[model samples]
Target chain A: MADQKDGNDRKTTVLEDLKGLKEVVKVKTQEQVEELKKPQETQLYRSIFRIKHDEEPRNRALSTLNNLFFHIHPAKVNRDATRYGYTWGLGGITFYLFIVLVFTGVMLMFYYHPTKVQAFRDILYLENDVPFGRLLRNMHRWAAHLMVMAVWLHMFRVFMSGSYKRPREFNWCVGVLLMVLTLLLSFTGYLLPDDQLGFWAVTVGTNMARATPLLGHQGPFGPQLGMTPYNDVRFALLGGSIVDANALLRAYIWHCIAIPLIASVFMGVHFWRVRKDGGISGPSPVMLESEAKN
Target chain B: MFGDWHQLWVIISTPDNIPIVAMLGLVPFFTWFAFHNMLANDRLIAQLEADPQLARTHHRTTYPYNSRWERELHTNPFLMRKELLAAIIITIILMVWALTLNAPLEEPANASVTMNPAKAPWYFLGLQEMLEYFDPWIAGVLVPTLIIIGLMAIPYIDANPLGNGYYTYHQRRHAVWTFLIGFEAIWLVLVCIGTFIRGPGFMWYWPTQTWDPDRVEFNVNRNLDQILGINGSWISHILPTAWRPEAAIIARALWGIIPMVVYGVLAALFIHWICKRSAYSRKIYSKMSIIQTVTMYIFLITMLFVPVTIFLRLVFRIKYIWETPWFSI
Candidate 1:
């Protein structure tokens, strides 16, 4: 009878151990739920975001100010500036298209070869065999065309709103240079496909460079200046007398590396000047002719 | 008529030509949209100007502004949200465009075989079209340089401070109109012509006309000196025997220069007249420095030269107004 009682005691001890394990698991799970409830308090989230995202006015401003990408924008803007009618969002759209171009352009570069023998065949292979290759090429080409149109429209909007006036004058000049760079970028990319359309188009384009005054072989006084097909500006442009293999390679370098770097530098100056010129030239109070200082 | 329509369809439907086709709709719509907002702002300005009390108290923008609401909004959610939406919309449009249309890849670049209507990309078409009226140096190099300089010079040259931030046609009529003429009447129109009108041989064809490679135009084009029957023989009589050989060249050069000089003077005077037309415009002109005035005249006359040369080419069939051994205008 004493042995049976001891066995009963052992059974109760095991049951109590199992119950304690269940309680521990439940309490741990609850603690985790509590921790997840305020994810902003987590070290990982804190380290990355740095600021708590909240409905407070300070946080709202901090959100823009603290972020590297968003910091290009001023924390506060004229309420009227948000209206589509004033700015038409053209400038922003152009910048976004550029970003899109860079992304897709990088992807395209992975598959393309700059040499004459390989360039055409690469394009064909990209279109036929590689998944989403056609879409990638189409996006790059169309986005390029879109970017040109956007640049024009942005200029138009700025002109219409007279945003180019005053302290913004130098910025406008920078913008003009950027516009030229944009066109050059598009033009260089035109020859990359190495197809008949691109080849002929680039041929005609460089042909005009042959007529650049003082620098071109066929231009006015060019021959007098001792310019020739071998040494004129066009030769320098194409890396040779004609749009051959070297021309293809030169175009690739310009389109991919050189111009983009230069353009990015100019773009940095353009945006910086915009801020220094007192944010966007405003949807501010219209000054009357009678109120003119001069 | 059906056949002609089909030819136009082919041109318009070409994958590469799609951007120019899209431009037809986009340019006009945006232009109208700009004018519409500009007109509204002008009306508001007029209203506020008439009422001194209202002018003092009124919010200047066309957008609704409640005094109780914040004058400035945080860029994070307020502006960034709209920007995000715009980016999304643009992405959708781009995706659709990429899926629907295939980028053109004309049979691998053959150097031996040339495209009958070989053309520059659509954006440079304006410059290419200018080649028809001017020398390549002028059209391709000088003009593009001038355009860039002229555009950059605008802010400095414009003296009127009335329309700085907002859109208003009344206060800045001259600036607005000049930009419209330059961008719309000249640049955009020339691009359209280059894309739609020029066919095989880069010859002018109506929108519906077939691109016949063999078609030839018989009209004889002449220079201004040729048409006027001016020659070196007459000038040689007035010169010494030693200068006789160069008389024809000098005469042709003079003929070209004289008219251009007259045109330049006339155009300058016209611009001056316009600038001084209204009380407000005169006020604006008076504010401009001498340097600004001269720079303005240079760009204005050059801009006017484009249309004048086109007129001479198309209507009078005159090739070069000023012809020399080296260069011709």
Candidate 2:
């Protein structure tokens, strides 16, 4: 009789445990379902508002932007468009244009100047004077600004996508170089006005140049490095041992012509390689989580 | 006017001065040589055509062999439309702008009088900024040399074919961020320090400390003048000290060995961290990291903002800030 009683209790306990396990499993599954459903929220907003409400006009605008000529990249590249945490995505094209600007810029420099006395006049001459002057200068300026915008967007896009991963490492390096070139191009071109702004900038800029190793002869390693002999490179660059009229002309030549040529060559290689390699990186998992629901 | 074979030594030694002598020396020699070569060619062609084996062989004429890709490329406008379009757009814009706005030309080149600020071309601003922060040896010479050499050696270093952009970052998580952050850091720091941190001498009109301007002036004149005497008063007199705060400390601590020490430490730390976290061998990490770091550094330098802002501000003279870290004067 006692053994039967104990057996009855044991059976009841087993039944209760089974019921508890079932409940737990149901809850866990429900939680996963909720997790899976979370991503659809943004899609709902996107479809309900941004896409649905203005679908026609927006789509048309996008189409225009994506056309072969005016547009820099696909209107909608990768969703990884704004991650500061990493770098990748739309940055490639920005670098490409920068290179293009540099190239055409150098060619344009066969006739350009950044001097108050001659800059504006030179522009007049280049346009009305040089055979293809007008077209070349405009293209260089436009491309430079466009490259700046592209590079900024590209950086933001990379940051958003979090594509700055292990394997795509060196391309990041290329991106950095492109960014520097963009700014340099802008800075040098700024002086072409030969206005007050141009004058001040060149003055500041040359001051900085003079700080160069062995050339500046002021830094820790300048004296130690034996950069004295190659001082002529600096002198020639400055157009004198000091920054004078020769310096201004030299800067003008370099800003307008010399460096642009070099930049163009490198830019070409960079872009060709970028296309040869591939387009932008796809979105990361974290980024996809928000999108996956839709 | 000309030397014969016997006097060839005199002609060779003073080659530049022997303008008439050169013509005299070459005229007869070339005249004789041309006849000999023309005659020799005739003999050789005759010998070849006369050969029994050549005569027996069927004479085959061949047209130029070109690939379909090449032939199609010649006619196909769409083949390189993107590049061509880019080029055209660039050309059109530059030409118009140049025509509308002519850049100034300063007075004909003179080296005596120095300008207030002297700068290199736009592309070189980053390097120019580097000269401001670190020793020019490191910034102007060594660092640039290393970057170029390193760039050339990229293919040999990172041989991994795993992620060429197809896979998501999750697949190659370690490599991506490492490249981005590391590159961004080096570039940002170098560019920022190069541009932003001009010596305090150039930053404000007066020293902040209670020290006498006269004493400071005397000291600067005594020590600084000697170092910078060669460039003279026109440019160097107005410029800031080449050294920055970090530079002085780094210079003193390492005795010219600081940069290398810093680079070594960072490299070792990076490799160790990567290895410990991923269980990947050091060899793999080193390869990926080298490409990753160099690439990042380049990218980071490209994004440098201080110099760009300074350049733009200087150009426009928009006095956005009345007082800046440097250039109060």
Candidate 3:
């Protein structure tokens, strides 16, 4: 009978030990779940962009490819290209300025009309009434001029580097085309304000346009081509003998809508080809050769 | 006043301009950063060779250890840094600039009252300055066309392959000289003259001279015709006939050829010098062949001609060095 009683006590102790072990396992699992939930707040953000902290380069490339914003750039760029010295960021700066122009230009349109009378008044209204209106006009004009200089400097840098060889030759032509477009856009915009500076400046500019050789009657050989005051490139451009209400309207549409669209297309081609052309010519053979000797 | 320079910055920093100022600030910062990076890299390269172990780890050597990644091969430290830096820096600059300076606004548009000097916008100041020297057609039409064409043709014509990536004076002397000279002589100098030197009458006024509406200078300019007393109507001056437009015109046209002959010879001799100095080699001459050589030389000389003609006008008041009914040479 004493032996039976000891057996009962040992069995009960074994059962109690099992209960304790189960409780410990349950508590540890609950603690792990809570710890995991702590990271979820940050994970919400990381998951939105599909970015991971420890992603290898493969994911970086995948991220770049999948994202619309990153498409303009390669998945990876050469460290050399990152150095501020090489291109002087002129090309990139020009692009940024263009973006600035687009943003501010749209703002100006809200208060502006292409008409001769309304154009100046609208500018005045923008300056006085609309919030931050004067700022937009100033930034737009400044950036327009700056973009012209920046593009030229970019071309100069490219020329100096001789990056315009072989594959880039066609792109160079496209660049020149873009420069012409930029000048035209600026020229047209110059007259839109219709101030003493704008009016007279456009007078000088359109008069030059009037002298386009094959296109205008005022130009040399224009008479032979049957270009006349009534029917010439200038007439088509201005819709009149000189810069009038019609001229303002024409410049307005071109400045606001037309040229920017054309520029956008060419710019797309320009940026796309930059990638195709091996992403900005790395230090070429001659550079390496010179370095080796040094 | 010198203080007027500061007035340009009295931008009336309203909320609207904050964006513009921010952008403007970024530009200078970006420029500074670039120069800083260049100097640092030079410093790095200077030390890398001294320590072979450092050089071994750096991509300064032909190979790098992280061969598994193509990015390691193509790229250096990183690129995303630059992209982000450029954006952030520009944003900051535009923000600051807009917060400080006011964009300029003048009176309403008046078609009736033209500004006295009636300047074109600054970009076209170069062309406007040229208009003073030549006929409207030549300065406005022909020159701009030629400039665009000439710029387009540079890559195709330039055969020197030695200076592809690196900017070196020794290897690419011809290209460097051509680009710098063209930029300085034609574009930059003319723009300066138009912007700073031109005054109310579209006349030459030094920067020290203020633009005064009351100032009236005389038209003391004497053309070649008047100086020589070669009145195209008065044949009695040099022609055998009495006062007749035809005889006087003939005599004047004949005299005009003299300068042409002088310039022609000068151009030829210069072309010869160019070919010889380039060692008569096709490789380093920027272009090959006699025709290409002659054309390039003439283009350079002609670019120089405008400035020289302007100089003669300012100093000697000489006009129509060579003249015809259609144009002047």
Candidate 4:
């Protein structure tokens, strides 16, 4: 009887303590409800929380973007692969150059005019008139040069690594197309300045176009220059008798707009395919043989 | 076939116009397909988690990374210091360089005037030089096409299993280095020689005849007659042929032979040398298969000299000492 009574008293004391604690919590929650009722108080608290946790939310958004974006391969890149000359391989550098081109090209578009009459003047204005215009142009020019070089290096890197082997043959062909497009982009851009250098360069370049087999007259075993069918491929390229203003306009459009848009499309596909094909393979033995011979 | 009204929604909603609209229409169909696969994976994970015994067995091996490299910047002390510093420095340098130099701007473009010394952009100069040697058909179209096709075909053709890097180069060093070094050396020489040598004229180099003003005038008259269509001679009448006042046949012949001979000898010597270097002999050659990569700077310097020599020869035709001893390729 004594033990039972002691247990009951102990239980009663514990319950009373719990009740007191519950009352305090109830009051606190009531106070929170009152604050929420006041819109300003709610907003202040929300703002304070946001200020404190802004970066966390931003990081989450960034991660989400990474998850969603299709171009990037989802794999964690190798952090310690510096056996080659650079930390990131040649492909990474080329990608970096592409980024630069995109950024600078956007800035340049503000001032650039695609028309034949204004194209030359706009280029001149960028060089001589605009503040930091010269630098922008220079950067654009140098970046273009570097982009080509990096791309070539990337191709060589892929070639030497034997990355193009087996299942990647189609992708390799796409890459080759990308390389040609890069050169074509550079060539068309060269004509944009419309200077003596640009004009003559186009002339000489187009002259070579005239020599194309089945297309041009300078074929090894085909129609001569003044034959029955005057299949002058060069004439067609110029859109008339010779390389005139029309050719310049065409080159400009292809350079500034068409080629870039096409390259971007292919680039997206290229990057996605790389992910699908399994992230880049390590160097193979064939590369080693090539190295040894060198 | 009945038209679907939903296609109109796709066409309107797509920001990139009609083609993008068609592609965007795939999203819902793909979403449904992907959702099924995702549910399957979820179910698998849930099943593994629900059974305590299975969870216990799988937990140890299933989790890919217990510890991973922190992706956030400034997380790793060493990496933060090195990468951040390097990126800053390089970006600044590039930006500054871009800012200072005004890009080249030439005179207003006119298609009418044929500018003398019409040079291709520096990067295209290699191909331009090649055009002079081979038929333009070969140089411009056939060669470029071949190069592209060859590159694409590489992956399929070279299917050796030594991809792990340990075994490939250990076998075939001779063929690889021979191809690489020989190719580079030859291209470098050809490009260099093409740049330096100007038009073979009497006043510039070995004179076939003493500087005769009267002979030049006579040739000029003949050239004008050919241009004006006054000349009835078959050679002049048939096609436009600019009269060479006094150019040496031997000099012209030498010009053609020297580049070929030089390239041939270099290629042969490189093959022979690499054959003897037994220590590094490997079957799969690397991109830089030989040490001749160090020689590229020399080649670049020589290429610069070629253009300079050509310019000097053109300006000072009478000055023999200034004239390059090398003939035009």
Candidate 5:
């Protein structure tokens, strides 16, 4: 204790000596800063970017809120949320795959068009003609597939963790919406290549949609509802009775724009609600061991 | 014949307007209800402040602290680091995979020349496989819808509240095992079969056998009519002449329906027995609502039914208990 006090006294004495040196040098330490700033402006916080370094606690407290990208995070969070073993960050990877898809998709669009006539040729050109077009297409295709897997696994994680309780119910619904949207996005993108596998896969898929009980024509109660080829749900989707140029254009528009827009709206709500609902569901140490035993 | 005025009125009025009508009517009610609750809460708080004894009596007890973490340790520096590491690892893996494999691009589509045994994508392969056994209405439409809705509704319908915020398979064994067996074992296994085991004309292929284009296999379905002797029955003779032919066909179909009816009857009796027992079974069974009880039995029966039906189909070559032009469910 005595040695620590002696060290502190020495530190204070050195600081006092620096004060004298500061006066002698008077090297624009305070006066220059004041002169540089407008009289109406304050001395601190005078920089364009928040360049001022505050105390550690205050700085850390405001770090999330002060930044644009980090605002999704709560100002306060539980230690349980930081534990890497609890959740495998599947949800984050799903979002990352979405980002990867968009980036590669936009680049691929530069070399392609959504028409039956040009779609196949565009793919060939991408593979044999354009530089790294194959890589771009591959990345997009693999990432879209990965996103579906990630979203499903994310839902599994959330369900197993039992995180969708009470106040979190609404967010859970949003998450399910996002999952369906993810699948829809992948489904719509499946036909853009216009290959046999893509074509038949979509044909089988939309054919299933045509059996949607009451809503679809070829489905149960469809004939009773007076559904015909021209008026059925599948026709509305394909924009014709068959998968033609119109179908290609419809898939492209949905994959590129509509689904992404809806997914973004749900994602924004999901993140904000997660923050508002105290940042990820986790067990707190406050529970009694007896209660835990049950 | 029934294009009457009232029927036309009901068709024109009720088909599309119900949803819009409901929404328009409920908006103001919900708005008012929100405000009413807020003001009521405020008034209650003021009243509590004015009288301590009544407030104490009304509150009755302290709120339970169920959380298991401390607040001071919830910062994100460690989490952010971990997230960054995961992203970097994933990016490397994705880059490696993209370089290693090319996306599948089969020959340009020809609608006239449909690919042999054309299949849906991997995710829907399980549903497609089921279409071999059941009607399109059930396998393709109803099953997928039920599975999706059931998954979403589980957290709401589950009776146990002990498994939240932790991984406790021991505590939630019933829930976990049901999901794993029903979805992973049955559905995903079917998907694997659909992907690898099936070949041209949807014929089962051994792994040793190469799927040759020239392979010829016939899938002749043997229904109850064929199995039970489509010879005219005694009931056909007793029935009126107009119904005689149809009655014989119905008697043949009844052979397939016998097992299903017996199974349902036995299950119902077993549940009734449980409700009368003097143990945990009785407690849980009696407490279950009608919907809950029915759902439990339905879930168990369906899980058992799939394997049994598949067994009968493969072993006995029984096709359908009931058949129609549109379905054979």
Candidate 6:
């Protein structure tokens, strides 16, 4: 009788233990659900974004100012500056095309080999074998061409708007350098395919280097200065007398690395100066000829 | 004629030539768009200038304005949105372009096989076209360098303060006309000529004419000195026998220099006359420093030289205006 009483007592204790455990689990799960419901309140989200994305003007301004990439832009811009008719967005388009070029160019670099024998074959293989390789190459080429056109138009627009006047003059000079770099970038990339078109085109191009005054073998007084096919500006440019394997490698490096680096530096200065020089040169209050300071 | 059209189509349809083809349309459209805005702004300026009361209260832009509205907008939503839209549109266009047209890849580069009428990439074709008129040193090297310098010099040389941040043809007439003539009439036109006109052997072919690789024309090019019958031997007549050879070179160089100097002086006088033509222009000209005026004259004269040389080449068949053993211009 005593043993049966002990067993009943033990059973009651076990049931009580199980119920206590279930209650604790239920409360903990509820807490977790409450936490997930307010994800914006989470530490991770707060750490990355820094500011809440609300409809407040402060947040809107912070969104541009705090971001790494978007910081290139000012928090607020002139209402007229946003108009499509004013800037035609050519400068921005040129920059966008440059970004496109860099992306596609990097992808292209994976398939290309800058050697005489393999260079042409690699392009062939890319066109035929690799997935979307032709698309990559086409995008790069077309974007490059588009970029050149855009740069020219940007300069044209700037000139027409008189945006290069006053304190903006230095920026204009930087812009001119950027334009030159853009052309150089395109010219260097042109020789990478190593096809007949590129070969002849580059040959014709580098041939002109042979006529660089005081540097080229065939230029005025170049011979008198000891310039020759073996050692002259053209030789220095191509790494030899002709556009061959070395020229291919040289062009590859310049197109991929050197000019891009230089261009990026110039572009940084150009943008910074634009802000320093008082934003996009207007569609501001037009100054009359009578108001002109003599 | 139909075959000629086909031939032209073949050239235009080539994948590499596509950019130049696009340029033909885009350049003219943008130019027209710019001029249209410029003229509208000019009319507005005229209206504003006529009435002081209206000028005092005017918003000064072509777009409609309201007093209640803010002068500025948040870049995040306004400018950024447009930029995003532009980026998306350009991406779509690029994607479509990539999908539809395959990038050109000709037979592997063969040094042994030269491309008939070998051309540089389309952008450099203007320089190549200039090669027909000037020596490689002048056309290929010097002109390109000068163009870069001239572009950089514009802001410094432009002393007129009338059209500081806006487009008004009347206010900045000289600047606008100079740029238009330099960019549209010369650079873009030369690019067109290089792309469409030059054919096999780099010879000029009318749009309707078929490119015949074997066609040859008589060479009628003559140097300026030769055209004037100023022989080196004739010039050597006044010098001792020992100094005769050197004197001939000196004489020829002097002859070349004379015409060049004459052209320069004439171009400068014309530019000066134009600058002083109007009362407003004179007011602006008076604002310029001596350095600015001279720099402007140099650039304007150099710019005019391109067309002058082109005319001489095409019409007069003159090869070299300034020719020496070392260099020819």
State which candidate has the highest TM-score: 1
Candidate 2: stretches off by over 4 Å: A1-116, A120-145, A148-187, A203-231, A252-294, B1-133, B144-156, B189-270, B281-329
Model 2 deviation from native, Cα RMSD in Å? 31.8
Q: Is candidate 2 or candidate 5 better by DockQ?
A: 5
List candidate 5 segments past 4 Å from native.
A1-55, A165-167, A214-217, A283-294, B1-71, B224-241, B248-259, B263-288
Per-model CA lDDT versus the true structure: 0.91, 0.45, 0.69, 0.51, 0.67, 0.89
lDDT of 4 at B92: 77
Clashing pairs in 1: none
* TM-score for chain B considered on its own, for each of the candidates: 0.97, 0.41, 0.71, 0.35, 0.69, 0.96
Per-prediction tally of clashes: 0, 61, 20, 28, 8, 0
Candidate with top lDDT is 1
Fraction of the native A-B contacts that model 4 recovers: 0.45
Give lDDT tens digits, candidate 3, residues B1-329: 23343323332142323333343454346435434533444455556646667666665422222646555321211565676688777667666665566565557777777787788766788899888887677788888887887777776666566556544454555676777677655686687677666767787766555566667777666657557776565445565545454765665676778776787678668655654574423335644656656666667667767777888887997766766554564
lDDT of 1 at A269: 98
lDDT of 3 at A176: 84
Q: Which whole-number lDDT from 0 to 100 does residue B32 have in model 5?
A: 45
Candidate 2's TM-score: 0.41
For candidate 6, give the lDDT of residue A257. Answer: 98
TM-score pick, better of 2 and 3: 3
Residue B82 C-alpha lDDT in model 3: 75
DockQ of each: 0.75, 0.04, 0.26, 0.19, 0.21, 0.74
Of 5 and 6, the candidate ahead on TM-score is 6
Cα-based RMSD of the predictions, in order? Answer: 4.5, 31.8, 8.7, 19.9, 16.5, 4.6
Deviation of model 5 at B52, angstroms: 35
TM per prediction: 0.96, 0.41, 0.78, 0.55, 0.75, 0.95
The ten-residue window of minimal lDDT in model 6 chain A covers A1-10
